[model samples]
Target: MIEYVARSGPPEAMNCPAFICDTCRNQVVAEGIVTWATTIGRDGDRGPHQQTPVYVAHKGRCGRGLELWIEQHYPAADGWIDLWDDLEDFVCQLTHNLTNAFADDTEGTYHPHRLVHPKERR
Candidate 1:
């Protein structure tokens, strides 16, 4: 997993669009897939600034094989640029949350597991 803030330049200089997860195909707004904030400057001299904090991973239930899918489909030759960090902070935090949730062992509470493939299920 990787986490970083992506900034887009002025309207004329804007190149890349917002990051979309390959697993979801931008169909749903899931966590760690597409997080952004738009700020309109009051000066009126510059266009609205968009800052997107992306958290990508390949092990999560929500988005597995996202990185590989993106790599194969959206190669850098087509103007796709890799702009994520090496640290898997998002995955680490997800694991930590799951560990804590399961450790609680609270009654009437549900702990969701990763999505399993139908063929892999026994």
Candidate 2:
């Protein structure tokens, strides 16, 4: 689980409104398909309950909305540029990128998730 600290000097939790499907806006967990690449913690009161290698819970809008928000707010970040109509594609890309970053596979070889986008599926 990633912790957010406010610039004002208070410990705060990070919440991304885009992660949840706009319709539900309920809490849900996302998991990585690749075991070695990435891992996300489980949702619980204890904060990041499990160190599982495939699970991230988000609330707000779906991946597509989240991608749009990311592009608008964090333009420099090229991670979630392509929109995903299928949630499965979104999950796959999310896990792949997260796993690569978490593993610190900076060699640009091992993970190589750089330019790959959901559109490539087409």
Candidate 3:
């Protein structure tokens, strides 16, 4: 249901091999690419947090598709991060922890889209 697109700079240009997964006839329930960057804070910045942010997005397949995916995928108890932290850790977590979680059936199925608005009550 979920797949790894690629690892590269944002957008991956126009004709990159990463675009192979570009088309899905079944209609993507939800899909997005993860982009990471390292930025140096300005002199007046404030925080004890890391110097980067992780961003995850999901261009939902339809108006209600996103909600359906969340209901069927993500779980009630799982760690989450903001879209503004160094994505390195977030991507790594998804690649390893979340994927493993999916297999173990112990935690949520891990959806980049659900990460934004994790759950909704029926």
Off by over 4 Å in 2: 1-25, 29-61, 76-108, 111-122
TM-score of each: 0.22, 0.23, 0.21
lDDT of 1 by residue, 6-120 (tens): 5577755444443345355442323454222222232452543322235343236544455444444444453333344323454476678875765576664442323322243
Question: lDDT (CA) for every model shown?
Answer: 0.40, 0.34, 0.33
Poorly placed runs, candidate 3 (over 4 Å): 1-83, 97-99, 103-122
**Regions more than 4 Å wrong, model 1:** 1-55, 58-64, 86-122
On lDDT, the stronger of 1 and 3 is 1
After superposition on all CA atoms, how large is the RMSD of candidate 1? 20.5
| Candidate closest to the true structure, highest lDDT | 1
Clashing pairs in 2: 20-60, 20-61, 21-62, 30-56, 31-54, 32-54, 37-99, 38-99
Candidate 2: how many backbone clashes?
Answer: 8
Better by lDDT, candidate 3 or 2: 2
Model 3's lDDT to the true fold? 0.33
Instruction: Kindly list the per-residue Cα lDDT of model 2 for residues 7-112, writing each as its tens digit.
Output: 3433755544433333234434452111111112213233221121221234333443454543443232322222223445655776788756645765553422
